[model samples]
Structures are given as C-alpha cells and as structure tokens.
Target: MPRWFYQLASPRWSYEIMGKLLPWFAIVTAALLVSGIVWALAFAPSDYQQGNSFRIIYIHVPSAILAQSCYMLMAIAGAIGLIWKMKVADMVAKSSAPIGATMALLALVTGAIWGKPTWGSWWVWDARLTSMLILLFLYLGVIALNSAIESEATAAQATAVLALVGLVNIPIIKYSVEWWNTLHQPATFTLTERPAMPAEMWVPLLVMVIGFYCFFAVSLMLRTRNEILHRERRARWVRELIEKQ
Candidate 1:
C-alpha cells in the first residue's frame, strides 16, 4: 500500500484489526455511557422552567449529535470507496447506515419527549426538526438500497451515490433553524460563543457527547468487522481465520 491507512483497504486486514480493537472500544464505550448517564440523570440540576423534564437532554443531545456525525462519516467513507474502489471503505459505509438510522430515530423520539414538556406538543414541522427527519429518511434509503441490490459492487456504488447526494441535506440540517424562524431554540452549545448554560449543566452534556461518540465507534467497529468477515469469507486469510475459530 502507498499509505499506511490505505493498506486497510483489504478486507482481511480490516477484519483482523477490527477484531483486535473491538473489545477495547466496547469497554470504553460502556464505561463512558454508564458514568455519563448516572451523572446526568442523578446529579445534574433541573432546569428552572423545564424542570426534571430537561434531563432528557442526556439522551436527546447525544443521539442528535451522533445522528448527524454518523451520516457525515458514512458519506466520507462512501466518497473514499467511490474514488478508490476500496472494499473496506464501502464496508464501513454500508455498516454505518443502520447505526446512523438508529441514532436518528432516538434523537427524534427523545426530542419529541423533551418537546412535549417544553413546547406542549410531541411534534412540530419546524425547520431543524424537519431537516433531521429527512436525515433519518436518507439513512433508511441507504440501508434499503444496500439490502436490495444483488451485487455487492452495484450496491456499494448506488449507496455511495445516494450518500454523496444526500450530503446536500447536511448543511441544510445544520442551518435550518438559523435560516428560518422556528420553535426550536438556537444552538445551546457553540464552538466560538460561550455556552448559555452554567458549566454544571453543559459539562454533563459534553461528557455525554463524548460518551456517545465512543459508543458510535464501538458500534461501527463491530458492524464493520462483521461486514469484512462476510465480504472476505472466500479469501485464504479468512478461511484460515475461520479455521482458527
């Protein structure tokens, strides 16, 4: 391979490496989520207005963050596969769709729950919320197309195209609330601006965000490893791997 990372284009190499790394990711993901959830649910202070209902932020915020991030991750990996014909990249893109969809669903559901208390409604057709809904549909479309196609290469190509096209929605999703006046509040967290909440509140949100990222990594690694094994099953290395198992 010309580059260190490109060598992992090989499905066999990807599988072995993923197998080795999965346990560590799983452990760390579990630890972070457990600690974060406990701290968020029990120790975090209630909002002055939203009351205990605001505690849903732990799940809602993390899932919302992961939902967007995973889609970008899939789109990037899809781009790599499209440009380089890398089987591992395609596998990563394929494996990431369902996970991303799950996170999106969680975000919507948790958002609705949090919304019911704050907004007096379970659903709203606001800009940010609508764009997030589209994101979920895009994830589902990718997964469905991947499953429907008979040929792996064709499936990858088709899904990659969809991912690339769907990327247009990412910016829209991000800026929807800004572009339109909506019930959804402006971002609570921002890179340049100081957070609106006290450190005690936002700190737990940050922790949950990090923990959710670890959980996503753990989930993606497991799914990617499974995909690699399936795609490489006919290879000599994979045969040897199965024999060892």
Candidate 2:
C-alpha cells in the first residue's frame, strides 16, 4: 500500500533491502532452531505412544510444511513472471527450486526414519506418502528443466509452466489423509482443533515450524539476490549498489 513497500517489488531495491535483512533472519533462525531442538529432544516429555520416535515429528512436519509452501511460493513467482513479464519474479522462481527440493527431500527422508519401527516398513504406497513422492518429482522436474535449457528466459518459461501444472498436487498432498485411508497419520497440527500432543510436545514443534519458515525466507532472499546480480550485471544501478557495499 505504501510507496516504500511497493518499491520493494523492484528487483534492485529488493536485493538491497534483503541483503541487509539476511543476517538478522539468519541469527533468529539459528536461535529458534537451537531452542526448538533442545526443547523437543530433552525438555519435552516423550510421547506415551511413540516414545522417543515422536520427536522426529518436529523436523518432519516442519520440513514437509516448508516443502509444500516453497513450491506454492515458487509457483506464484512463476505466475507473476509469466503474467507480468517480471524478470525478478522469474529469477526468484529459478533460485527457489533447489531449496524447495532440499526441503522435500528432508521431509521424505525424515518421514521414512519415523516410519521404520512404527510401520514396519521404510516406504509405503499410502496416499500421503504417494502424494509426497509425487511432490518431490515435481521439484526435481522443475530444477532439471531450469538447468537443461540454454537461455535463462526460456528455462524460466518452461519451469513456470511446469510449476503451474504442478500446483494441482499441493491440495492433493494436503488433503490426502482426509480423502483416503493412509498409513500416514493425520495432521498433528491444525488451526481449528486442539493439538493432538501435549503443550510440551507441540510447543517445540510450533517453534521449529516458525524457524523453518524464517530460514526459507532467508534462503529465498539470498538466492534471489544472487540471481538479481547475475542478471543485472550490466546495469549501472547494480554496479552502483555493489560499489556502495
């Protein structure tokens, strides 16, 4: 709404502001992650049902949430680039692919780790697991497409189309537990109902989720800034900005 806020929509200004903000976000993320890990691993009481295995939920859930969110955010960026011819938006979408893919990989691996003793299997074809695997494929597809193409613009366009098409999977992943019988448990954290875990258990999970989001934000900004510089290397404004820094 404000003039200054709108100015941030500009890639040059966004990079500058985000560069200044990155250290603070990094610090906060480190603090939150450390506190959350300590609280979840030690201070929080073990689950009566899963014992120490439930502690894996903190990392798994948060990474899964971030993985999904980052995909959606990247899709939105792709849409903006395609619709408005925004170079910055395309750059952002490009930069976000690896990070989103990493989060998805973490979510899947952590989920598998939590599943082994509880489910008696390392993998499952259940709805949630199946949908998540598809999500990972989508991330890989986007990243691979980005790298395979020669021209950045053409790559961005291809990835944007792929991301837009992949958007259909997001809802499927979110609602898979509700829609079908699955080995995977339903949402542990829900906005509308009381949490399934006790305060001690869920609180650390909430902290970890917040920390994951902050870390994602910081990563996106840093990656996008690098992209902005790489693309804008010939711009006088970029040269001036670099000189000032």
Candidate 3:
C-alpha cells in the first residue's frame, strides 16, 4: 500500500486531515449552494408545463442524487473496514448513515411536493417513487442495526453486511423509470449526452449538484471526526488533543 493509504487507517491522521479540509469544503458548499439557489430560483427559465413549480427541481434533484451517492460511500467505507480492519473506515461508515438517511428523507419529501404539482397527487405507488422509498428504509435499517448492537466492532460488522446486501436496491432505484411504465420521469442529467434542458437551466442544476456533494463532504468529515474522537477517547493523541483544546 502507498504511504498515504496507510496513513488513512490512522484515526488521528484522518481526524486531523478532515479538520484541515472541512473549512475548504464548507466554503465551497456555501458559495455553490447560494449561487445555485439564486440562479435556479431567480434566473433559470421555468418549464413550459410546470412553470415556477419546476424550480423545486434545484433542491429535489440534488438531494436525491446526494442520497444515492451517500449510500454508495457508506457501503464502500464499510467494505474497506471489513476487508482491512480499518477503524477509520468504520467511523466513516457509521457517520454516513444518518446523513444519508436525512438526504433520502429530503429527497422523498421534495419528490412528493414536486409530484403534487406535476402528478396532481402527493403520493404515488410508482416504481421510481417506491424504489426511492425503499432506499430510505434501507438507510434507516443500517442506522437501527448499528444502534442495536452493544459492541462497537460487532455493530460495524452487522451494519456493513446490511449495507452490502442493500447495494442491490441501488441499481433498482436507478433503472426503475426505464424498466417500468412509471409516472416518474427519467434522469435530467447524464454523462453520455447533453441535457435536454437549455444551458441557462442546467447550469444552475449542475452547480447545485456540485454544491450538494461539497455539503455532503463537509457533513461526513465533521461526523467522522466526532466518531474518531469518541472511539479513540482513550488514545494518547485524543487525550492530548482534548488537553490542547
């Protein structure tokens, strides 16, 4: 392994690095979110059909995307912990669950709000909607399982297995719109093709997506730092850190 990869296993190193990076991520998140919200709500052209109601996409789309991305990160972090016995990875996986759950909830609530305007109903059994709901439940399950176990290592192992098993749901969520005749629309952005929407609208959406990612990074780092300190409270470095503070 590279020196940097080995360094990542060190809780103190991970915590220090996160502390250093947090400010930058926070700054970027604030800038992009503010700019994106302003550009999206004030400047972007309204959809011909949905009109002003379409502006909600700025929030809905990014939250939905972030929820999925957070799940992936959680699962991957869990895998690393399982494979390498890395405490830092376990902390990251543990920290990710609540944040991911919040993002999923935000996505679902926003989706319902957006759906009410577009589909004329606040709730639907549509494939995409149902799958997204499942995703949220999966996050909650991980969180519940983590808290249920008394041993920290045991809890990490249990949640890691659950997260890995839940990976199957991610693909289902991604393809639900295409595989079924669902009321939900397809993705707004894809790497292979230009967005159907004009530049003026998509630009802000892009900014919002990037901003959401930065926000997630900031949240994860903060949470992970806390986890590290708690888990390593007995360590000399943690004691030193506390004494210095």
Candidate 4:
C-alpha cells in the first residue's frame, strides 16, 4: 500500500483534509456557477432556430453530464469499500447516493423542458431519454436499498453490489442516441472532437459544465464530511472536534 492509500484509510485524516478542501471547492463553485449562468442565460446569443428556449441546454446538458458522472463516482466508492473494507469508502458511497439521485432528477426535468420546443413533446420514450430515465431509477434504487438495510456494513455491501450491477446502464445512456433512431439529438460536446457550435454558444456551455462539476465536488465533500462525523461520532478525535465546535 502506498502512503496516500494509507492516508485515505484514516477517517480522521480524510475528514480533516476535506475540511480544508471544502472552502476552495465552494469558492470555485460559486464563481463558476454565477459566471456561467450570467453568460449563458443573459449575454449569449439566442439560437438561430429555438430562440430563448435553447438556453435551457445550459442547464440540461450540464445536469445530464453530472448525473452520469455522479453515478460513476458512487459506484467507484462502493467498489473501494467492497475491496478494502474501508469505512470511509463506505460512508462516501452512502453519502453520494442522494446527490447522484438529485442530479439524475435534474437531468430528466431539464431534458423534458428542452424537449417541448425542439422535439415538440415534453416527454418521449426515445432511446437516449429512456436510458437516462433508467439511470435515474438506478440512482433511486441504490438510495432505497441503502435505506432499507438496517446494519451499516450490510447496507454498504448491498449498495456496492447493486451499484456494480447498474454499471451497464452508463454506456447505454451514452450511446443510445447514436445506436438507435432516437428523437433526442446526439452529444453536442466531446473531448476528442471540436464542438459543432460557434464559440458564443459552446463557450458558455463549457463554463456551465465545469461549474456543475465544481458544484458536485462541493456537495460531495460536504455530504461525505457529515457522513464521517456521524460514523465517527464516538471517536476521541471526533468528540474533541465537536467540543471545539
């Protein structure tokens, strides 16, 4: 085991590190979110076709991207716990569930809103949309399974298995539009290729995407910190910190 791995295994150390890091994520989240919203919603040019309705992409695309990424994080955390029996990893997996679920819900709602004008329907069982809906259900299922189990260790174990099983859906969600005759358009952004849109449209979107990631980082840290405190409530260091607070 490397030194960093051991450092991560220590709950007290991880908690303290997160405490130091939270403020920085919070600051960046606020700055990026504010700038992204203003730039995308207020200043950016309206779409040549959809007009103001297209601005919803700023919210929808970022939410959709974050929704997928959050699930991956939860699954990875769960895997770490299962492999190493790390209590901190279990707590992280548990803390991540609600956040991921919320992001999924946001994605679905914003996608529906974006659909009304462009696709002419508020909701559709299109491939990409359907897969994304399934992703949301998977998130909810993980949350429900965790809540249903009584023992902490048992719950974490169960959640880890379920998260791993649901890993199949991520790819399906990513490729659905491409593989099927879906009403939803294909991805507007990609890493390997340049964006199809002009900078005016994509630049703000890029900012929003990064801002959403920062926001997710902030939420994950806060929730994981709370989970750490609760799980370690009886530890001497935790008690000392609580008393200091």
Expressed as tens digits, the lDDT of each residue in 37-118 for candidate 2 is: 9999989998787888988999999999999999999999999888877788898899888999999999999999999988
Whole-model lDDT values for every prediction: 0.89, 0.91, 0.94, 0.90
lDDT of 4: 0.90
Lowest summed lDDT window (length 10), candidate 4: 1-10
List residue ranges in candidate 2 displaced over 4 A. 1-6, 241-245
Ranking by TM-score: 3, 4, 1, 2
Which 10 consecutive positions of candidate 3 have the poorest summed lDDT?
Answer: 126-135
How much lDDT does candidate 1 score?
A: 0.89
Best by TM-score: 3
For each predicted model, how many residue pairs clash, with residues at least 3 apart or on different chains? Answer: 0, 0, 0, 0
TM-score of each: 0.97, 0.95, 0.99, 0.98
Q: Candidate 1: which stretches are off by over 4 Å? A: none
Question: TM-score of the candidate numbered 1?
Answer: 0.97
Of 2 and 4, the candidate ahead on TM-score is 4
lDDT assessment of candidate 3? 0.94
Over the stretch 83-157, how does candidate 4's per-residue lDDT look in tens digits? 999999898888888888888889899888889889889998898888888888988899899889999999999
Model 1, position 83: C-alpha lDDT score: 91
> After best superposition, candidate 1 residue 137: deviation in angstroms?
0.6
